[model samples]
Target: MLLKTDLTSEQLLAVIFDYMAKISSESKLDRVLVLMANMGREMIVADRCTVWLIDEAKQELYTTVAHGVKEIRIPAGTGLVGHAIAAGEPIIIEDAYDDPRHNSDNDKKTGYVTKSIITIPFRNNDGQIIGAYQAINKMTEAGKFAPKDMELLSLAASYAGKSLESVMLHQEIVDTQREIIATMGEIGEIRSKETANHVKRVAEYSYVLALGLGLSRHDAEVLRTVSPMHDIGKVAIPDSVLNKPGKLTDEEYEIIKSHTKIGHQLLRGSRRELLSAAAIVAEQHHEKWDGGGYPNGLKGEEIHIFGRITAVADVFDALSAERVYKAAWPLEKIEKLFREERGRHFDPAVVDVFFAELPKLLQIRDELTDKE
Candidate 1:
C-alpha cells in the first residue's frame, strides 16, 4: 500500500487501461487482482485494500486478497462492504470505528487496525450490484478518505465485474480440461490393474517438479495434464504381463518394457500438443539418466526433459505406493533411494529439484491417493 512513486492522472489511467485491455477469458486473474489492489492503494493513498466479489445466490461477499487471510466471506448487509452493496453506491468513512456499519472483526483477526475507509460497489449493465472494492486507513496526513477517493474508486470498481466474468469463463474451461485429462489417464491405468490414482499423482508430481525447476506456469500445467499418459502403452500389454502378482520373468519383463514403444506408437504423429507431449513422455519415461533403462536406453541429457521429469515423478510415486507385487517403501527409505539414485537412475537436477519441493510433493500424494 506504500507508494513507491507519486501517482499522476495520466499514469493512473495508464494502469487502468492496461489491465482493462488485458482482460479476457484466458488472462491471469491473480496477477490482475494484485495490480488492481496496488493501483487502488496508490490512487486513494490508503495503507490497505481489498477487491471482493458478491455471490448473489448466497448473498455473500468474499475476497481472496485480504491481508493475512485465507479467504474472507461475509453475509450481505453485514458490514461496510455489505452496506455499500445494499445501497448500490460508494461509502466514505472518515472515522471507521465511529461508523456502526464498519466491521472491525477482520482488522482484529488479521492484526491490522482500521481507521478510515472507502467502499465502492460495482454494477452490471442490468444495474445489478456485482461486487465491492474497499480501501482502508488512508495514509495521508489528514488520516481521512476524501470524496475524491470515493469517486476514483467507484470508477475503477465499475470495470471489475467485466473482468470477473472473464475469469469465471476461464475457470470453467480449466475445470472441463481437468476432468478430460483425468479420464483419459485413468482409462489406460485402469486396464493394467494399476491404481486408478497413479496417473493423477504422477501428473501432480510432474507439475510440482516442473515448477520447482523454473518452468513457466503454462508449461507446468501442460506437463501435469500430459504426464498421466506416460503408461498409455501399457494398455497394449496382456493382462497376464501387466497384472502379474509376482516378479516378472525375464521374457515378461522384456514384454513390459515394450510398452514404452507401444505407448509411443499409439500416440505418435498427433498434431495436438497434448497428444504429442504425451507420446514423448510415454516413450521416454522409462529411459534412465545412465542409459541403462529399457526401450531406447537414451542417457543423461540425451533424454527429453519431460521424460526426465516424469521418470523421477513416476518412480517416486510407484516406489512409495503399495502395489500388488510389493509393499510401500518407508518414507525415509524412499528419500534415501532417491538420493542414492541421483545421477544414476534419475536426472541429478530433476531429482534435486523434486526433493527440494518435497512438501508439495507429499501434499500432491495426499490429494490423489488410491482409494482404500
Candidate 2:
C-alpha cells in the first residue's frame, strides 16, 4: 500500500529534529547508519532505504545500513548514486528502468523491483560528499518524486552533513588527547634520564599482561598509559642517591625508598582516570606479593590491578637496563628471576603473562635499545 497523504510542515520539522538528536547520541558509524535508515523509512514512508558509505582511501562505496535489501558496492562513477556523488547533487527518477543511470544489479540482489528512486549525496559540513542516501520505490500513486519532495530531502541532507562533521571532530579530539598523554608520559621518563623508548616498552608490557589476564580493553589501555608513571618518584630523589655508581649505604637507601611516598604525594587526590591510575602505580609499584614492601606493605590482592601489572613491567625493564650500579641482565636471567619471585615478590598471574609473551617482550627490548 502506498501513502497518499503528505505530513504537515510542523510534524515533519519535529521529526527531523528528533532524528538529529538520535543521530547525535550514537558514537559508532554503523549505529548511526542504522538510525538514519530507520528514520528515513518512517519520515518519508518509502518501501526501502539503504545507506552507502564512501571509503575515501579506496575510492569505493560500501553498504552501511539496509532494509528489505542486500548491500551493494559501487565505484564512485558507476551508476545513479555514484553519479549523484560525483556531481554533488540529487537525482530523482519517475521510472528507474527508463533512466540510463539505473543499475539493475542492485535490484537483482535485493529481489525488490525498483519502480522509482531518489538518490542524494550525503555530505559533511565541509561540503565533501561522504556517501549516498537512497530511497527505493517511493510508494506513491503517481510513482514519482515531486519538486516538493526533493526540497524536503535537501533540507534533511543539510542537517546530516553537520551531524557527521560533529562526530569526526569529536574523534579527532580524542586522538589528540591520547597523543598528548603519551608525550607527557615520555617527558616524565626523561626527567630521570631514562630513554623515552624504555617507558614505551613498560607501557606495552603492562597492556599485554592485563590482556593476557582477561582484563577488558579499556582496563588494558588504562594500565598501559599509567604504568610509565611508576618511576616518576625518582625525579624527587637527590642526584647523589639516584646516580650513585656504587651500592647505597643505609642512609642513602632510605632516601631512595622515599621516592615511592613522594610519588604518591605528587599524584593523589585526582578524579581524572589516568591520573588516579598513576597515583596507584606510584604508591604501590614497588609493593611485593608478600607483606615486605614499603609505604603500606599491602600484600596479595590488597594491591590495585594497575599497580600489580606495572610492578612486573617496571621490574623487567629495570633488570634489563644498564644503570651505573648494575649491568643489564640477559633475558634468560630475567626469566629465572621472575620464576623465582612468583607469588613471593611478584604477582603470580602477571608473571605467567610475562613469560607467555617473553619472545615478544624480547623483541620490544631489542627494538627499544640496541646499545648493550
Candidate 3:
C-alpha cells in the first residue's frame, strides 16, 4: 500500500485519474463498490475500507463489499458512518474506542481490532447525500488518520457517489423492464386459462437446463427472463380455439400454431438484447428437431438455441402439470416420453441435459408449484 505522504502531486493526480477511468467504465453496482473501496484503501493507506449505502426502503445502512466481512446491515443512524451521514460531513476519529459514535460490535464479531477511522459522506449528482465511505486503521506509525487522509477519501467519495447513482439507476430500469415482461407473460398465460406459475416454472427450469448445458451464468439468466414471454403471442389467440376442451379440428389447430408467429412479430421490433432473445424463443420454441414442427419448420441446429432450450422447459412443465384439458402426466411417463423422443421431438443433447438435471428441475417445480 502506498502512503499518501509518499506520492508527489503529479503522481497523486495520475492515480486519481486512473481510478476515475476505472469507475466510469463499470455499470454493475457491486463491482463499482469494490472499485471505490479499493480506491479509498489505497489512497488513504488504510488496512480496510467499506462503502455503505443507505437503503431508503429498509431504512438501513448496508454494505455488500467490505474488507474482512461477508455482508453487514445496520440502522441508518448507527455507528461512525451513520454519524457522518446524519451530520452530512466527514468524521475523523484518531482513536475509535475513544469516540462515543464508534461501534465496537463489528470488531468484536470479526475478531479484528479497530484503532483509527475516517468517514466521509458522499452525494449524488443532485447534491443529495446518499452514502458514506469509511476507512479504518490507517497504516501509519501512529495508526491514526490525518487531515491529508480525509482530503484523499473525500476526493474518492465524490466520484464514487456519482458512479453509484448511475449504476443504481440502471439497475432500477432493468428491474422495471423485468416486471413488465413478467406481467405481460402472465397475461398471455391467463388468456389460455393457465396459471402464471407455468411461466415461472419454465423460467427456472430453463435456467437450470441452460447452466447444465454449459451456458454462461449471464446467458442463463437472460434466458430465464425472456422464456416467460415465449407464449406472449397467446394473448392474441381467440378463446374458442385456445381454451377448447375437446380435440381441435385441423382448421382450429392451424390457428393455435399461429401464436408463434404472432409472438415473434410482437417482440421482434425491439433491438434490446433481452427482447430480441424473447422474439427468437417465441417464434422457434415449437419447431421440431426433425423439421416437422410449425411456423418455419426450422430443423435441428437451425432452431435457435434459446428456442430449443425453452422447448424442453416448456414441454416438461406442460406435461408434468395438470392443465385445463388434461391431467398431469406421471414423472415416469414423462421421462419415458422424453427418452423416446430424444432426437425426434427434442434436441438429443437437451433431452440428455433434462435427465441429467432432473433433480434440480423437480426441485424448482416443487418450490414454485401451482397454488391450485
Candidate 4:
C-alpha cells in the first residue's frame, strides 16, 4: 500500500493521472474495473477495493473483480456501496460493523473483518450515477478511512466511470455482432433441416480446439463467434440436395459442395473482422491437409488456421451426432477415423488439439445436445 502521507499532493495527482491514462486505453471492461480497483486501493491506502457496477436490467449490483472474493451480486441499494450510489455521494465509515448500511455477509463469508470503508459514487459522462468504488480497511496507523481517503477515491472513481462506460459500450456492440453471426449460422443449418445446436456445438468445439492450439483468447473467441457460419453456404443449396436423406449422386454432391463458395462469396466482401473471418471459415472448412478436400484443395498450412480448426470441430460433431443420412458413430469409430486421417483429412496439429481437448468438446456437446 502506498502511504497517503508519503506522497506530496502533486505526486499523488501525478499517480492518479498515470492510472487514468491506463484506464482510458483499456478496451475490456473487466480489465478496466481491475485498474480502477487497484488505483482506488493505492490512492486510499486501503487493504482492498471493489468496483461495483449497477445492473439496471437486473436491479442488482455486481462485481466481477472484487478483491479476495468471487463474482458477487447483491440487490441494488443493499450494501454500503449501494447506499452511497443511492445517495449519490461519498461515504466514510470508521467502523463498518457499527454502520446500519454496511453488509457483513461478505465479511462473514470470507472471514475477513471489516474495519474502515470509503465508498464514492461514480458517474457516466451525463453525470448520472452508474456505480460506486468501495475501499476497505485503511492501512494507515489511524486504521480508519479519513476524509482525504474519500477525496482520493472520488477522483479515481470519476475517471473510472467514463472509461468503464466506454468499454461496456464496446462490449455490448461486440456481443450483438456475435449474436447476429450465430443466428445467421443457425438459419443456414435450419434451411438444410439440421439442428441449430449443430452450429452451436461446432462453434464451442472450435473454440476449444483453437485455445488448445495456443491461439489467444481473443482469437479463440473470434473463431467461436464465426465458426457457426461454416455451413452458411448451405443456405444457397437447393433443398433437395441439401436435405437429401439418401446418398447424393455425383452431380448432387458437387452441387452440395458449392455452398462453401457461396457462403464465402456472401461474407467475403464485408470489411468487419468478424465477417472476414466467417468468410474464411465458410470457404475452407472442408479443405484437406493433403490437398484432397474441397473448393480449392489448399494444402497443409496454406489452409487458414480458422478453417483448419473448424474442420476438425465440424467433422467431429457431424460424425458423433446422428444425421438424416447416417447414425451417430460410436466414440471408438470417431477416434479411429480421426487417427487414420490425422494428416490426410485434417491438419495434423488441429487433429492433435481436438484429441487434447476432447473432454471439453464432449462436455460442450452434452450441454448443447440437440433435442429429439
Candidate 5:
C-alpha cells in the first residue's frame, strides 16, 4: 500500500536542494518546524514524521511545531529517538518493537503500532548535539529504513539546525531591540509620570489593528515593534508640561504638541527599518482624519496609514488604561467614543476594523493589563 520511487540519486539531491530553497523564505519558528517535518516525511516516504529539539536547560527532547501527536518531551537517553541523539548518529530501526532502545509508551498511549523508524541527530555550528529528527513507518515496498535514508535525513536535519540557529539569533536581536524600545518608551513615560505599560499596550493594540486592516503579518509585526515609540519625544518635554495633573494653558498645550516633531527628529534618518517606521508613527500619530489635527493638517488618506492605524490603537489603549490625570474610561464610553469619532478624529476604516475585531483587542488589553 506504498508508492515506490524509481528516481535516481541525482533526483533526490535535487529534491533536497529545492527544500532548502523553499524554507529559506520562511521566518516564523513554528512555520519553519512544520515545514521541516513535512519535508522529512516526503523525503523518507514515511507515514508520519516529527522534529524534536533539545531543551538544553531542561535536559529533555521536546516537539517543536510538528503536527499529529501531542507535543511530547522525554528525557535524554530515554528511547530510540533519544538513543540516536545520545549516540550522535542516525539510526535505522527495521523492527522498532524488537529494538531494546525503542520506547513503546507513546504507541500504547496513542493506540498506534510502530514498525520502522529513522532518527537523526541535529547539530550546531560547533558540532554540538542540539536535537533529533524522526520519520516513522517508512511506506515503501521494502517496508524498512535504508542507508540512503539516514544520509538524506541527516542532511535535512543539518539544514533544519542551521535554519533554527538563524531564527533564534534573529529573535535575540529582536528582543534586544524591544528592550531598548521599552526602555526609551518607559523613560519618556516616567518623565510625564504616565501610567506604566502604556507603551506595551499601544504596541499590542496597534498590531491587532494592523492585522484587521489587512496588513501582512510582517507589516503588522513592524507596527507592533515600532508603535511603542509614538511618545518617545515626551523625553524632551519639561516635567511641568509633561506631568501636569490636569488641563494645560494655551502656551503649554502648544509646547506639548511640539513633542511630535521632537520625537520625529529623534527617530528619523535611521537606516534601520524598524526605526524608520517608528519615525513616521511618532511624527503623525496625532494627525487627524478630517484635516483638523496635528503638526501638519494632512487629511483623509493623506495621513500615512501607519499613523492613521496607530491613532486608533493609541487612543483606545490610552482611554481604556488608567492615566496619571484621569480614571480609566468604562468600555461603554470607549466604544461610544470610537463610534462618535469614526470619521472625525480617527480613520473610518481603522475605527470600523477596531470594533469588528473587538474581542481580540479586549483580550489583548486584559491579558497585558498594566502592573500596579
Candidate 6:
C-alpha cells in the first residue's frame, strides 16, 4: 500500500478539529452531512461513499447523502453495518459477497452492487454508540485496499466519531432551548385565555412568514420561539382589564397597554438571542408602521425588522382567535383587515407573504383550534 504524506498526524488532528467545529455550529442536517462527506472523501482515499446513522430505538440505519440511495434499516445483528454497531468496532470487508455478515438485498432494491465496504461505529465521550459511519468501494490504484490503508481509514473514522459527538451535543442544546421556550410560553398563556396550541400556531406562522421574507433559518427559528412572547406582558394585567366583556374603559385600556412595556422590561436583560427577539416583539408588536401605536410610537423603518414582522403575526392571530371581548372573526374578514391595514398597521411585504400561503395558514388555524 502506498500512502499520501500531505498531512502529519498532528496536521490531520487539526483539520479534524476544524471540521468538528464547523459541524458543531451547523443546525441544518444536510449541510452538516455534506461537510462531513467531503471530509471523509478527502481525508480517506475512497470512491463512492455512503454514511449511515444508527437509530438504535428503531433498530435502523439512515442515510443523509442523496447518492441515488435512501436509508436502509436492518435488525441490529443482521448486516455488516449492524454488526459494526453491535460490536462497537470497525468492520472492513474486502469482499462483501463472501462475508456472512453482508446483506445483499438492499443493493438489489437500489440496483447498485457493493464491491467493498467499511463500516465504523461512532461513540460519544460517554461510551454510548451514537451512530455508525460507513464508506464503501475504495477506488484503489490496485484492485484492493491494503493493511496500511485500513489503518489510515481507522484514524479518519476516529476523527469522524468526535465530529458526530459534537453534532449530538449541539442537537441536545437546541432541544433543551426549545423545551424552555415552550414552558415559558405556556406559563404566559395561563395568564390569559390563550392555549398552548395557540402559542404553537403563532410560532409556526411566524416561522413561515420569516422564511418567506428571506430571513435565515436560524433567525426564523429564533423569531418563531420568541413571537409567542408578544402578549407575555398581559400576564401582569388586572383581570378587570384582561377579561373585560365590553370594550375597556380608557383607564383599563391604558393599564392593558402597559403589558407591552412590562414584557419588554422583563425580557430586555437576557443575553439569549431568543429573549432579545422576544423583547423586540414585546416592545414593538404594538408599534404602528405610520408612527401611531404603542408606548414609544416608533415609526416606519425605525422599528426593528423583527418587531414589524411580529406585529403582523400577533394581530393576525388575535383577530382570527376567539377572545374574551370578541368572537373569532371570519377568515375573509381577517384577510380584508390585513389588506386594508397594509403599510398602516402592518408591514406590507410581510403581509404579502402571509397571504401567499393563506390556505395553509387557515389549515393550521383549523388544525390547532382550541377544543374549549
Off by over 4 Å in 6: 1-30, 42-48, 52-66, 71-78, 125-129, 140-144, 238-240, 322-325, 356-360, 366-372
Residue by residue across 135-203, what tens digits does model 6's lDDT show? 666665554555665666666566666766677666667667667767777777877767887788888
Cα lDDT tens digits for candidate 4, 155-254: 7887788888889898888788788898999999899877899998998898889889999999999999999999999988988888887889999999
| lDDT of candidate 5 over 177-275, digit per residue (tens) | 777777887778777776457777888888888999999998999988888888888888888887787789999999999989999999899787778
Look at candidate 2 and give me any clashing residue pairs. Answer: none
Superposed Cα deviation of residue 227, candidate 3 (Å): 1.1
Task: Judging by lDDT against the true structure, name the best candidate.
Answer: 3
- Give the higher-lDDT candidate: 3 or 4: 3
Deviation of model 5 at 27, angstroms: 2.8
Residue pairs with clashing backbones, model 1:
233-263
Clashes counted in candidate 5 amount to 0
What is the C-alpha local distance difference test score of each model? 0.81, 0.79, 0.91, 0.89, 0.85, 0.76
Candidate 1 per-residue C-alpha lDDT over 1-372 given as tens digits, one digit per residue, 9 for 90 to 100? 443443589977887777566543235666666666766776777788888877778888898776446678999888999988888878888888899998888778777778888888876556777777889888866778777788778777767666665676566676665576567678888888677789888988999899999999888888898898888888788999888878899999999999899989988997766667888998999888999986888998899889999999999998888876678898999999999999989999998998799999988888777777
What local lDDT does model 4 show for residue 93? 84
lDDT of 3 by residue, 1-372 (tens): 444444567877877888889989987788899999988987877899999999999999999989999889999899999989999989998888999989899889889999899999999999999999999988866668889988888989988898899999987777777888899999999998888999999999999999999999889999999999999999998999998888999999999999999999999988777888989999999999999898998999999889999999999999998865789899999999999998898999999999999999999988988876
lDDT of 2 at 99: 89
What would the per-residue lDDT of candidate 2 be over residues 60-90, giving only the tens digit for each residue?
8878578865566777787888889889889
Residue 205 lDDT (model 1): 93
lDDT of 3: 0.91
Please identify model 1 stretches exceeding 4 Å from their true place.
1-26, 55-59, 68-70, 123-129, 183-187, 200-226, 232-241, 244-280, 287-302, 328-372
Task: Give each model a TM-score.
Answer: 0.71, 0.62, 0.90, 0.90, 0.84, 0.80
- Among these predictions, the greatest TM-score belongs to 3
Model 5, 137: alpha-carbon shift in Å?
1.5
- What lDDT score is found at residue 367 in candidate 3? 92
